[model samples]
Target chain A: AQRVTQPEKLLSVFKGAPVELKCNYSYSGSPELFWYVQYSRQRLQLLLRHISRESIKGFTADLNKGETSFHLKKPFAQEEDSAMYYCALSLTGGGNKLTFGTGTQLKVEL
Target chain B: DVKVTQSSRYLVKRTGEKVFLECVQDMDHENMFWYRQDPGLGLRLIYFSYDVKMKEKGDIPEGYSVSREKKERFSLILESASTNQTSMYLCASSSPIRPARGGYTFGSGTRLTVV
Candidate 1:
């Protein structure tokens, strides 16, 4: 079975501080990893995917096959960057069904 | 832009009542999904359809069922409403061919409350 784990439920950081939302997955085969974000009163949107390897809003996540982790990281936390983040995994070519982690709530303090 | 729309922004239903959550995608994508979102649990897939009239059970599908009579629309049905089923339900759609750009397009979500 495919599973994603996000250890932190809430992560509070002061503005301009570095932020890292941990994400790990359990899958035997090659899997696709994605980071999704939901801002206050907004719809859930895709932040980035491992396949793309492109940074979005200063957030980047590298898929580590050996460690089975895809941690989302940002150089500096911004007030507006506070939101709920989720790590998701999908089979590389298997119909695109996703299994998501519990999620992490990031609070950027002023 | 591709748009996935949920029919309701909020709904309240009594226990044992049947509940229907509708989702429609304007894009010609081939896949549609229904997920329930809770505070700490994030989003759990309830059901998904790859093609019209084809449905598949997701991780948490015991209390839920789904219908997909059309390619662009999928409906999630709660057999019997229960307080445990109260959550924010999201609808999403995506293309199966483009794995690189197959990120789901999601709707605003429907907040369901079972009393």
Candidate 2:
């Protein structure tokens, strides 16, 4: 069974502090991982994908196949960055159907 | 811009009542999905449609049915709404471009409460 796991239910950091949201998966094949964020009262949106190897909103996630991880990281946390973040994986041979992990709620405090 | 729209932001229905939740996408996406979100469970797929009139069962398709009569619309129906069915229903659509990099465009989500 393929599963995605977000170990942290809540992560808190002071403003300007570095933040890391952990994500791990259990799959038998190559993985395609993504980070999605949902702001208060806003629609869920993609933050970054490992395949892109690019940062969005100063956030980056690297897919570590050896460890089966794709942790999201940011150098400096901002108040506006506080939101519920989810890690998702598409099935290997499916029509883009996603399997999401229980999200991690990140709070950037002052 | 990819635009996905849900029919309602909030809804209330009585137990055993028939319910319908509609979603539409303007981006001509080839794939559309319905998911129910809970506090700690994140999002669980209910059903998905790859094209008009084509439907597939997702991870959690029990107690839910879906329809896709046209290219832009997908509907989720509950034959008999139950309290456990109360959740945030999210609709997502995405094109098949760059399968690895393609991220889904989600709607604002519908908060349904079954009494």
Candidate 3:
């Protein structure tokens, strides 16, 4: 079975500090990973995907197949970056279903 | 921009009552999904529809049924609402082709409370 695990339930960091949200996945086939974000009173939205290899809002994630992990990272955390982050995995076959992690609440404090 | 809309932002109902949560998408997507979000448990898929009148059970489909009479609308029905059923329901839509290439579009989510 495919599964996504985000170890931290809550993470606090001061503004301008580096932030890293850990994510680990379990799957048998080639993995497709993604990072989703939900801000206060905002709908959940896609932040980045491993395949795109593009940074969004100064955040980037690299798929580490050897470690079976895809950690989201940002060089400098901003106050506006406080939100809930979820890691997801796309099923390998033709279906569009996704398995999501429990999510991590990131709080950037002043 | 692709848009997925849920009918309500918040709702409260009594136990054993029948509940209906409606979702509509203007993007004409082929895939629509229903999920319930809970603290610590994350978001668990309740059900999904691939086409008109076609539905599939997701990870957590118990106590729930679905209807998709039209391609643009997907409805989740709780046969008998229970206190444990209270949750934030989210509706999402995505294209079947190359779903990995493009991420899903989500709604504002309906926060349902069963008292």
Candidate 4:
């Protein structure tokens, strides 16, 4: 079974500090990876996709095939960056069906 | 902008009552999904449909059923609402067109409370 694991339940960082949220996946074949974010009282939206390799809101993630990790990174955190982050995986050409991880709550403190 | 709209923003129901959650997408996406979001569990997929009247069981599909009568509408049904079923329900839609750029569009979500 394909599974996505987000190691941290909560990550607290001061504003302007670097942020890294860990994510690892177990899949036999090649997979498409994604990062999704949900702000307070807002809908879940796509942050970045490995296939696209485009950064959103200063957040970027690189898919590590060897380590099977796709950790989200931000050079400097902002107060508004605090939200619940999810790591998701989908089989290549699987028709957009995704398997999401447990998620990590990122709290950016001022 | 393309949109996925869920019927209710919030709902309260008694235990053992049947519950229906409706989802509609205006983007004409080919796939629609139903997920339940809990504090620690994140978003667990309950069901998904790739085409009209075609439903697929997701990772956690027990106690939940789905209906996709039309291409734009997908309905999630809880056979009998239970306290454990109380959570924020999310609806999402996606398509093969521009899959990389447009990953998925999600609804605002429905917060369901079963007491």
What CA RMSD would you report for each candidate? 1.2, 1.2, 1.3, 1.4
Runs in model 4 deviating more than 4 A are none
Tens digit per residue, CA lDDT, model 1, B1-115? 6399899999999999999999999988898999999988889999998999999999899999999999988999999999999999999998887644449889999999999
Which clashing pairs does model 2 show? none
TM-score of 3: 0.97
**Candidate number with greatest DockQ:** 1
Q: Taking the tens digit of each residue's C-alpha lDDT, what string does model 3 give over A19-62?
A: 99999999878878999999999999999989889999999999
lDDT of 4 at B60: 89
TM-score on alpha carbons, each prediction: 0.97, 0.97, 0.97, 0.96
Alpha-carbon error at A30 in model 4, in Å? Answer: 0.3
Task: Rate residue A62 of model 2 by lDDT.
Answer: 90
Q: What DockQ results for candidate 1?
A: 0.77
A33-110 per-residue lDDT for model 4 (tens digits) = 999999997889999999888889999999999999999999999999999999999986666789999999999999
Give per-residue CA lDDT, model 4, range B1-115, as digits (tens): 6389899999999999999999999988888999989988888989999899999999889999999999999999999999999899999998866654338889999999999
State how far residue B111 of model 1 sits from its true place (Å).
Answer: 0.8
What does the lDDT read for residue A109 in candidate 4?
A: 100
The DockQ of each candidate is 0.77, 0.76, 0.71, 0.71
